[model samples]
Target: MYVQSENPVEITEAILKMDIRPKDLIVLLVAESDNLNLQALIDRLNEAGVSFIGGIFPGVIHNSTLHKVGVVVKKLQSVSAPVIIQGLNTSDYRWPDFTPTLSGLEKKVTAWIMIDGLMPNIASFLSGLYDRLGDRVNFIGGGAGSLTLEQKPCLLTPNGLLQDAAVIALLDYDTHLGVKHGWKRLAGPIVATRTSHNIIYELNWEEAFTVYKNYVEKDCDCKMSPANFFEISKCYPFGISKSNAEEVVRDPISVNSDGGLVCVGEVPENTVLNIMKGIPENLIAAAAEAVEETLNQSAHNDYVRHTMVVDCVSRALFLEDRHEEELEQISRRIKAVRPEVSPQGMLSLGEISSYGEGYLEFFNKTIVIGSLY
Candidate 1:
């Protein structure tokens, strides 16, 4: 069951009115960057013995309509355990301490993860998790942050609100994952000559921003400047290629004073990078394809409990007015295949999934769909 309301109090009231006691709940909320009172809302849900895991996104999908400011609550029937790990900034971040807890769980488990989008060491965190869990658990989730690109206490846990931390909900159910990013290479197999964490200082021995500016100005016929970097860079992102899997895109958020580029994820030194581009039609088509892939891989086609979509907000910002069309495309495609499955999603800062036999990755400008059975 799913419910939506602009008022948090109303959301709690509606959940209380339900006759069924939900084993777990997932929340997708849209509120002013500074106005979100997650603690108050969590307290209300806790009083009723309702456990939940989710975060505040720029916008949320309730049914087929997208709401910029509201609460979308998904009542999950499967039993779940929510775990919160703090101190993501500490250099000693380790997963072995939590290995015993995860090993004690049932053999079959699916994890939904939400981490701080602005955390500098997201790649390290992901590597640690994949090393510990391996293919034993299926993963699907995205980064939780504000549209302003500021790191706030957005991720919600039963303990309260948190920042620079990650939350995982281990579900006792089967899930099928599908991922797609619809971005074609614009130019460059250029090498990243210099980098520090998430900032790229140089590409092919030239200043990173200089290389990027020349490419954008030449391809798009638009003059590039630091003030207009974000507006122009959204249409053109950086793609890191892999041998067998689709390229992982990194969104350039801004340009630095030293002519470096700041991206959503790390751009390791010596890594090959390509400028990627996308359009509305291809992006919508990719979303439909993602739905088809998920349905094809589902274990129980006759009874899919729910479908969750974590699409990058950069795509939404790029599509602008036509963004709703992407959602409608996904809805139509899913309905054509499985009319019983309902889709709900959030426009995330970044996306996560391990489709087919691929390793889990944190992607930008991508769409990830997961179907639970």
Candidate 2:
């Protein structure tokens, strides 16, 4: 359920009033624009002895609408208590072992991962997580942070709101995953010569910003400044090449002082990239395609318990008013399968999923759909 009241007291009251089971875990996907005192809300929940794990995102999705000021509270059953991991911004850290936690569970499990979107070592952390868990457990989630691009206490937990941290929980529900980004390649295979975590210092042995600026300026017939970088770069994102698959997009959120490009996720050194562009119609179509892929992945999926969408916030920014069309497409397709389930999720900073049972990845300007059964 989604709550529109920004008042911390009212929100807590709504949560407490819910007919939640003793073991049911609550998820709070709050909108960044609400400007609520998250600590106060957390304090209220703690006082009431309620357990929850979630974050503040750029926006929340309820049904087919994108709400910039509200809370999307999800009650998850057959799920384990959340495990919090810190030091995501640093390079060296150990992923917690979940073997003991899952030993007693008889059914197959899926992991819901929520990380600090602005953390630099997101790819590294995810890689470590996948290595530890492997494909034994399906993974689906997205990065959470504000659109302001400022790192702060955004992620909520039993302790309080924290930064540079991650919350993970294991769910017993079976999930069908579909990942897609309708961005077509407009410019070619530029190599990132130098990169550190999420910062690209060089492309083809030159300044990353300089190379990016040249292509975008010539194509769009306009100059780019730090002031207008986000406004213009939203239309053009860099895509990392993946063999025989859609290019994994990386959103360049800002330009750094050293002429580097800071992306939402990491860009490894020497990785080939492409400048990608998308039309509103194509993006909307891709949303439907994601639903089709998820529904088609399993033949016996006659009943869907719930549908969760982790769509890119940047896609909404680019599509503008037409973003509703994208959501509507997702809604229309899901309704065809199970009319009872409505798509509910957040407009994330980065989307996460195991690509076609391949491997876990963090993506930007992409949509990840998970149908729970």
Candidate 3:
């Protein structure tokens, strides 16, 4: 069952009212960036014996409405174990080192991952997780951070809150995942000539911003400036190509004085990239298509209990007034598949999923729909 309320005390009371004891629960909280009482809320849930995993988001979805200040809870019907790992820095993190810790769990496990959105090692982290778990473990989750862009202890695990770290909940259940980013390549597969970490210094042997500005100005017919970069860049993102898979997007956060571009995730040197753009209608349609695909892949005999939608906040910002329409599109499709289940989601900083066919990747300007049974 799903429950939400703006008042912390009221939300806790509602969870306690549920007569059926849940083996686990997932919590999504949308609070002010400067709110310092987060620890108290976690302590309250811990004292109540609710095993949960989630984090702070700019906005959360409950039923069909998007809320900016509230707590959304999903009571898990099956047992789950949350593994919290810390000490994740740009230089010193490996998935193989953590693989041994996940051993001895059930054969059919679904892993739900939540990571710091600002962490520069996200690409390496996803690659390492896929290398260790292979295709045996199904997973879907997103980056957790506030609108302020400052890193903090946003991820909540059973132990406590975490920052610059990741939390994984290994569940013994079945799940179906569908991923889509409604972005089309606007320009060539240009090579990233010089890059370090998440900063791109040059593209195609030219200044990164120079090339970016030329293409964007030509495509959108608008002049580019540092002041208006974000406002205009939201409609245009960088797409990194992969073999036989949909392109992964990276949102450029800002431009450096050296004319380099700083992105949310790493843009490795020699990586081929394409300038991408999306229309609001196309993005909404892609979300609906994702829901349809997920339903089609699901086992017909098994009943779906809950659906989790993790979409990039960049898309939400792009949609603006039509943001709720995107959610409505998802709801309409999900209801057509299974009217009994309601979809709950959040505007994530980034999205994570692999559909159980390939290596997991951290994506931006994308939508990930997951069905948990």
Query: Which numbered prediction scores highest in lDDT against the true structure?
Result: 2
Best by TM-score: 2
Clashing residue pairs in candidate 1 are none
Error of 2 at 329 (Å): 0.8
Sort the predicted structures by TM-score, highest score first. Answer: 2, 1, 3
Clashes of 3: 0
lDDT of 1 by residue, 1-373 (tens): 4444445576778767665455555554443333546677788777877767768788777556776766666666544457777889787864535566567766656777888877877877887888777787788888888888888877877788878888877676678887888889999898999998889999999999999999989988989899999999999999999887778899999998999999887778998999998888888888888888888875577777778888899999999998888889887777776787667878898887775635778899999988877
TM-score for all models, in order of appearance: 0.93, 0.96, 0.91
Cand. 1 Cα-lDDT: 0.79
Give the Cα-based TM-score of candidate 3 against the true structure: 0.91
**Higher-ranked by lDDT: 1 or 3:** 1
Error of 3 at 324 (Å): 1.7
RMSD of each: 2.2, 1.4, 2.5
CA lDDT, candidate 2, residue 97: 74
**For residues 125-210, could you state the per-residue lDDT of candidate 3 as single tens digits?**
77777877777777888888977667777787766778888887766566788899889989988899999888899999999999
